[model samples]
Target: MHIVIPIITAVVGIIVGAVIGFLYRKTVAEKEIGSAEQEATRIINDAIKSGETKKREAILEAKDEIHKSRTEAEREIKERRNETQKLERRLIQREEALDKKSDAVEQKAEELDRRLAKVQKTQEESEEVRAKQIAELERISGFSRDEAKEYLVSTIEREAQHDAAVKLREIMQKAKDEADANARELISIAIQRCAADHVAEATVSVVPLPNDEMKGRIIGREGRNIRTLETLTGVDLIIDDTPEAITLSSFDPVRREVARMTLEKLIADGRIHPARIEEMVEKSRKEIEQIMKAEGERATFEVGIHNLHPELVKLLGRLRYRTSYGQNVLKHSIEVAHVAGILAAELGLDPVPARRAGLLHDIGKAVDHEVEGSHVSIGVDLAKRYKENPAIVHAIAAHHGDVEPESIIACLVQAADAISAARPGARRENLENYIKRLEKLEEIANTTTGVASSYAIQAGREIRIIVKPEQVSDDAMVLLSRDIAKHIEDELDYPGQIKINMIRETRVVEYAK
Candidate 1:
């Protein structure tokens, strides 16, 4: 039994060993298979991860390409849209401009057609009228159109000439008669109204002394009195040259008048001291002022212009001592006022205003030495300062034509001034200058372009210029007269005025035997 047990145990041992080896082999194989499976799984997983990565990259690239294409398409679409809009705007503007052009062309064509139709109608009417007139002319007077027209024109011209000659003669005769009567009336009225003393020559004012011995008193200790008198009066005192008589030498008439009154007072008082001299001068000045006021009042009353400032009245009175071109200023002003009043009444104007303007027209002469401008300008300023009417100021300024006349009254003032200055004996001129001015007047008239004869009449106050009818027309005669007057005014200086007459005559003579 023992033997059998040992054998079995060995067999079991061998079997166990074989099983162990087989199990070892099986484990090895399992490890190898697991390793192979793990490797394969790793390779497959790696390939899948790489494939997904490639696929994702390809998708991203595709998306990027799609975005680029979309952006390009959008840019191209925007360009196309912009181009389309520009074309539409251009087309719309072109269409509007074309419509305006078409309308303008149509209007022009309509206007042209209307004008052409009117012209055609006018031509047709003119042709019909001309034909009718020609036919009528041919039927009448037994003449062709041109011959009948000539005959009619000649007949009318002859008849007009005969009628014009008769009418001209009658008109001239009537005009002469009327002019003579008016002249006579004006002269008689002017002479009757203005009867002032005729001043032949300027006289030197003399202040007589009470006694010959008073002249020594006037001389003073060292002729201080005479020197003071000369200084004060701006005149020379001839104390030694005459006995009981003194001569006042001054260029200014006003100064001479003042000095004469002062010397007369001093002689009457018999006090020849400087204080007495000054007092006498002051008294004389007051007396002169009073005299001026009285003269001004008289003038104003005469002129029918009463309302005036006391100062203005005194100034007007001073004009009594003033002269212009040897014409008394106050007298001239009065005459001008009268003439202006008459003219204003005739012209339907207010005579009071016109007369006032005329009287104050020469107010500048009172202050002319103190003021710088022309008398007209000075008078205008004075009137304006005194709150005179604007029309009156304008008349004062325009009376001498220094300014443009602003009204009919201003022109009337000028006319009155001229008339007053132009009256005979109203102003005086030296004999030599008078004769020379007359000769110059005749010479100037003869120098006219169409003058055939010239004559200076009425003491050189009027000039008559005869012009050849062929050389001078009726209008030319008027122009020539104006030119002559202007030339005389520019070239000559004389008192009063020179009247210019341009006469043109056309004479037709035929021998009747």
Candidate 2:
């Protein structure tokens, strides 16, 4: 009983301690909860202050931005207003200026109208005066008003014609002076550039024999050898009294050359048979052909030309044997080419075509013996056949002034040809023919109207026509000169060209008063 009581007392003490412990834990928990509530309230207050600060800052920033935008807007509006006011001021000034200009124009128009009215009144007064003068003139001169008016009109027309003639003379003289200078310079340049040697070709070929015995051997077997040679070579063998020389005469230079070579070979070989003669002639022919080709190549090389048709080259070489009025045709062609090229270079034209045309200008002479036409016609046909440029063909045809020169190249070719042929000893003309040519030139000029006298000078190179000043006005002198030139060109067959000069002067004789 005693042990149970003690145990029950201990149990009661333990319960009391447990109760105290529970109360202590509850108090601590309540204090902690209260602290947490205080902390939450403090945190909520701090958040509210932060939010207010941010809102106030944002509001201030928005107000500042709004103020800035409003300020900019106001500034822009002020600037626009200023610009608009300036534009309006300018517009108003322009309107005022236009108004002034309009007023000035109106004043000028009014003045012009007044002047026109004054002019009309003056014209009326002048018409009355003119009518009274006409009446007086008709009464005094025993002429009607119509006759007086016609006489006055004729006099005015004469004066006008005289003035117009003088003006025309001045213009023509100025233009001719400039043109003549340019032409003279170009021709001089061409002549200076072309320094070709003159080759005086002839229709006869003289072969030097070893002895006079060779002449008899040449005419062997009762003139059978000479006959065979003439028939084969188409040339005349003239056995003249000249010692150690035989003359081969033929109009065809090629045939004459072939005959000369054939005779020379026969003399050298001392084989006088017909068979050997034929063989030698054939060899001579082939050799001459080769020489012709070589000459053609040399000519092209010298002239700096290339790409010629083989047949054309051969024909060009044929010109080496040809002659026209004692001038070597091939040499003449080369000279003409040089002159033409020089002229073309000076005149700013292509020298190649000019040179080519000039080289082939006398190509017709090569085949003229075979063809029945003028060298110009034959040359044109040949050029066309060779597929040459039309300008080149025209140049060839017009080199002799046979056809009208249609281009500058053709005109240059004509001038070059003239210069080439006009050189001293370049051509042969009998004294009789030369005198006749001069007389014909003077006659052509004298037949023209208003020509007092005509003189052909410079070996008929130029004709000077003196015109009566009273009959020929300055303008008429120009026309008369042209007409005479044209007529001379049509009627006369001249070498190179002829220059026609018309002289007209009024010499008023007045002694000192």
Candidate 3:
């Protein structure tokens, strides 16, 4: 029994212990669950707080963005409104300006209408006055209105015809005088502007000898050297006592030049032998040919002419040795070219053709000595052979009034040629002959019926006659001038052109105190 009681107690003790352990474990588990629940609630609460903070921040950022967008849109709208206001202001200003302009135009139109009505009334009054005057005129003339009207018309017609005739005479006379004056001025200007030097050339070339002893050397052993030189050069060597000078006389200028050069070289080299003379003569011939070509080129260059044939250029250079009436032909031609160019420019024509024509106008004279034709015909042929412009050819042919001038350029060339030939010191004329020309011009002017006095001016280029105004009527002055010019043309042999001027003036002197 004692052993059973102890064993049972031990079993009860074991069971109670196990129940307490179970209760304790159950309480620990409940506490752990509560802690886990609190932890989970805290995590949930933290997550919700974090989510609320992020949502608020996002809302704030979105609000800021919306506010910024609204501000920008408001600024844009303000700018557009400002622009619209400016446009409206400009439109208003333009409308006001237009309205003012319309009002001004309307005012001007009203004023024009008033003036038109006033002019119409004035015209009506004038018509009434003319009608009354006509009626009175008819009554006084003891005739019907139609008959009186016809008579008045005939009278007025006669008066108008007389007035028209008088006016025509005045206009014609004025035009003639102006033309003469203008021509004189233009010619004077051309002459004044021309500054070319006038060279006087002769058929003889004078060479200076080194010494009187040299002249003996030139005459050489029995004059053989002199004879050889004269034969080769075809010139007359006149070893005269003119102070160390020998004169080479030749009708041909080229021959004279060659002889002059040959003699100069012989004198310079102190070699007067026949062989040296022949060599020098041949050399000088070549030199002269080169010189002629160079001179031709220089002339064309000076005159601004180009594209000329080589043969033509050489011929032009030959004109440098030619003389007409003591005037160097080349110099005269250059002067004529300058004058023609000037005149052509003044007349609004091409100066190139004028200058070319004038330069080549006298080219025929270069070969006229060799050719059996007039200079004009030879010039025409030369220009044609050289393929010159036809107008240039015509100008060359017509420069001397040979063939009637078919073109204005030809006429210009003729006038220029005459001007160059007629300028003072251009040509040689005896003093007696010149004085006689002036006297003849004066006498011709004096022969006119209404001449109170006569004066020949401008080297007989112009003849001025003062006429009595009472004797020579204004209309008669024109007739007198024409008659005087006609008479001079018919009877006088004047060079270049002559002007016949008739002056009819009535002096009305009034003293103003």
Candidate 4:
């Protein structure tokens, strides 16, 4: 029991001691916390004071910055305002100057208008005076103003024409001395050397029949034979009352030739049937083809031109049957080739190409009747098709003056063609055409101003114009001739150059009282 009591007391004592210790620790903790809060309060108070000092410094700095910025802005504003005032003053001055200029321009314009009105009034007054003077002069001279003006104009025109004629004569004389002599010599030489024969052949071929009875045979069994022949050969058989003659007419010489040959063969064979006519026509076509080929070859050989296309050679041969104004085209072509070659030789150029071009210059004429274009165009196309030289093609195209001749060979071909066609006896026109040509020549001269009388002499080759001595002076005669010649060249299609002769005779035939 004693031991238990002591143990309880000890335990109570230990509990008391732990309670005291706990209380002491709690008091110490509160004291330490209170001291720490006071230290934190002191630090916070110092921070507030430092913050207040820094805020005051910042306010002072901001105030100073605002004052400096305001000062600079005011100074800049004043400068800009001063500049704006100066610009405004300059604009006002310029406006004033522009207004002064406008006023001066207006005054000058008014002055000019006033002067113009004064000048117009003066002109009207002068016109009135001129009208009065003209009326008085017209009354005194017994000539109207229009008639007097016409007379004055005529006089001026005559004088001007005389002066122009003098100038033209001088120029022509100079040109003749420089170029015409050589040109004339070359043309004459070429023409003389190219002496080709020409026989007048027409589109109609006259095939002699054995008897008039043969006409019935040719007409043949309801005209079937003639129809077949014409159909085969593209020729017209004119069976007329002409004794022992049958005319084979066709514009195409090749067809006419074929028809002629067929008729001859049928007559000789004594078998006048449609089938025989067909066979004969076919055979004649072949024969004509062969003849053409031979002629083409002959042309090439004669021209001394080689390497021609086969088709081109055949076309050349076809030209053998063609005619131009009753002149054999093949002969003309051959002559042109010769003349062209001679001219080329004289010009110190290659003659072979010139001759070739001249020979083929009229190549288109061979197929012109069958084609739908001019001979020049057809010839150019054919030459191009045959792959001829470009120079030769150009010559062919330019031979008829269809195109400008650019190459020497082309010009030579042109000259040669002109010479061939223009030489004496080279071509002939029908009587009607000849008379029309002469009449046209005379008419041209007669219609010319101041022409007193005119006559076409030398078979329409020369036109003699007798001018009025008072109207057309001696100096004007040269210009009149030139003008007339130019007119003839432009209007007429003659073979050769025409001669224009101007005769001005002034005889002062007064009465010998």
Candidate 5:
């Protein structure tokens, strides 16, 4: 039992030694960790101090830069202020100089007024002396001032009238000579220089067939083909009485053209059915539009008129199917343009505007059938709607005398229209009616006042009237001619213009004769 007790004591002593060694080791480890933490804190404090120093340096630099900028701005402001003060001083000096010049001018004006007043007083005195001299002379002549003045005025008026009559005769003679020669040369040159394609009025359009057998096909079962064609084309189809040719008749030229094209296309396709006819008609209408556009472009190019409104160009193309009397309207328009241009050039006018106006003058005829008014009125309205120049609108309206001509261009347009229409073979009229009308016009002129005799000349385009000098004075003859013209205009429905010539002669016979 004693051995066991000593063993337990030895174990107890060993346990105590182990516990003290563990405590010492733990204490040393704690000391080491504290030293490491203090060293880390010292390093962090140094880093923070370095960052603060950089921030302070940046702030100091920013403040210094701001101060520098302020100093520069102050210097610039001072410089600008000095410049403004210098400019103000110069302006003050200029104003002082202007004031001095104004004062000098006012003084000169006052002196001139004083001098004018003195001159007026002198003139009054001179007038009084002249009046006394005139009164003495009148008394010596045994005539009062009023009577003498009346006789002098009468004598002067008689002499002046005689001189004026002589001068007027000379002026009229010169003007007539120049005007006649100019008109002849201009009209002749214009006619000769312009060459237009001859196009006759076509009442019937002919469509050529590929073969004789096709004509039979065109006249389908029970005449259904021809009936459908007529119904679709709005034209009468005369399929018989011709070999390999069919006639399309329509009063409207545009309809006739469309019908002709539609038939030609249907024949080429060898398809003769109602459905085919409708399709072909529609296609032909489109083709006609394209042709119309192309023709319009061609006409504009030929006339050298550009930038026409698209609608205006299309209307111009429509003139291709229009006829005036017997002349093709498109060709006639081209001719008129040429004539108007030549005449305008000779008259020292702008030829392009004149030519353009001429080309478009008859454009209203294209739409006259569809529209309510005469072509002139329609054309004027159209031109105005398109924002055309007022002169151009005036020319359009007055070409037919539907409106009063306001410009020289308008008169030129009327003259060109007349020349175009009056040219031989340009138009056709009923011979019997034309002759009867001319006879009636002559009869009417002969029946007018101051109409001693009358004769129609120039294919009844002009009438020459002889007047009795005693009954009709020179002034009365002028009035008589105007009256005759008005009567003719009101009484006749002539295609073109008619001129009236009134002749009054006064003969003074001498023994030498």
Candidate 6:
């Protein structure tokens, strides 16, 4: 009980100390709150004063900006009103100037109308005066206006014709003096150097049989042997009643020769059978080919031409069987080559190409029966394909006057061909046809205007035309010749070229009594 009393007294003392400590802390917190409230009030009053000053400054800046904008706008408007007043004054001045110009233009237009009327009156008076003068001139002169014009034009035309004729004559005389003699000399020499005999080749070849019985045998049983021979040789075996003779007919001379040889061999063998015929035909074909090859080689050797394509050489061999107007083509080609070479020599040109061209000019004739085209076209193609000289190819194309001759060699070949073909007996034509051709040539020249007379000379190779000096001016002869030549070319198919000889003679005579 004594310990409990001491503990109660100690507890009372602890409670009293706690009450005193709580009161002290509460009094300190109240003082801090009072000071914080005073600081907040001062801060709020300072912020309001600063905000009011900033607002006043912004309002003053805004008012100054508004006043400056209003002043600038009023000044701009005043300047625009002044410019508008100046533009209005300028427009009024322009309008007054235009009115003055329009009055001036109207006065000028009225004056132009009055002048135009006066000019019309003056033109009418001039016309009347011109009419009177023309009438008086017509009365004084014998001719009217149109008649005078016609007469003057005709006189002018005649004078022009005379002058042209004289000038043309002078030019032609000069040209003739320059070139005619040399051309004639060269041609004559070429012709003289190459004189070849023309043998008229028969298209059909004649074969002899031993007897009449041979024909029967060749005909064979049911004609099997004959058919086989024809089929193999591609030739017609005509077993006619011509006294132990058979004719082999084919456009291809090689085939004809083969047929002839086959027939001859079969006759000799005395074995008339299809098999025998075939065998003989084949043998004869190969033999003919060999003969042709030899002939080709011989021709090239004769012409002094080397390095010819083998195919070209073979074609030359074929010319042996070709015939033109009954003239042996091979012989003709050789003649042409000789003539061309001679001409080339005379002209100081290379004769080799001339000769080559001349020889190959008719080469196409060798294959004309097999190919489709004129011999000239075929020859050109062959020459090009064989890689011959371009000059040689051109010569071949132009040899027959199919194209214009461009080179001297081509010209030589042309002249050589003409000389070769124009030889007497070189070709054959019906006598009646010959006479008609000559007559037609003369007729063409005679029918022309101003041609007094015409005569065909040189086997229709030349036509001599005599023109009336009065009707045809000297200069007109050239034109006349060309016209007649053109007509002849268009109307007549001829060999070689025709020469147009013009003759104009003016004779003056005065008798002294």
Predictions in order: lDDT: 0.82, 0.87, 0.89, 0.89, 0.84, 0.87
Expressed as tens digits, the lDDT of each residue in 137-158 for candidate 4 is 9989999988999999999997
Worst 10 residues of 3 by lDDT: 196-205
Q: Residue pairs in steric clash, candidate 2?
A: none
- lDDT value, candidate 2, whole model: 0.87
> Residue 153 in model 2: shift from native, Å?
4.8
Compared with the true structure, the alpha-carbon lDDT of candidate 5 equals: 0.84
For candidate 1, the TM-score is 0.58
What local lDDT does model 5 show for residue 471?
81
Candidates 1 and 2: which is better by lDDT? 2
RMSD of each: 15.4, 11.4, 16.7, 8.1, 16.3, 8.3
TM-score of decoy 2: 0.69
Per-candidate clashes, comma-separated: 0, 0, 0, 0, 0, 1
TM-score of 3: 0.58
**Candidate 6 lDDT by residue in tens digits, 193-287:** 77678555655599988999888888888998788888888888888779989888887888887888888898888988988888888898888
lDDT of 5 by residue, 171-249 (tens): 8679979988988898888878888655456444788887889888888898888888788778888777688898877
Better of 3 and 6 by lDDT: 3
TM-score of each: 0.58, 0.69, 0.58, 0.67, 0.59, 0.66
Tens-digit lDDT track for model 3 on 1-513? 999999999999999999999999999999999999999999999999999999999999999999999999999999999999999999999999999999999999999999999999999999999999988887898888888779889989867766766787879779979998987877777777778875456555889877799889999999989999998999999987798999888888888889998998999899888999999999999999999999999999998999999999999888888888888888888899999988888877899999999999999999887899999999999999989999999999999877899998999899999888887777887789889988988888887788999999988888889999978877567667778888888777666888777778899999999
Tell me which residue pairs clash in candidate 3.
Answer: none
If ranked by lDDT, best first, what sequence of candidates would result?
4, 3, 6, 2, 5, 1
Kindly provide the TM-score of model 4 when superposed on the true structure, using C-alpha atoms.
Answer: 0.67
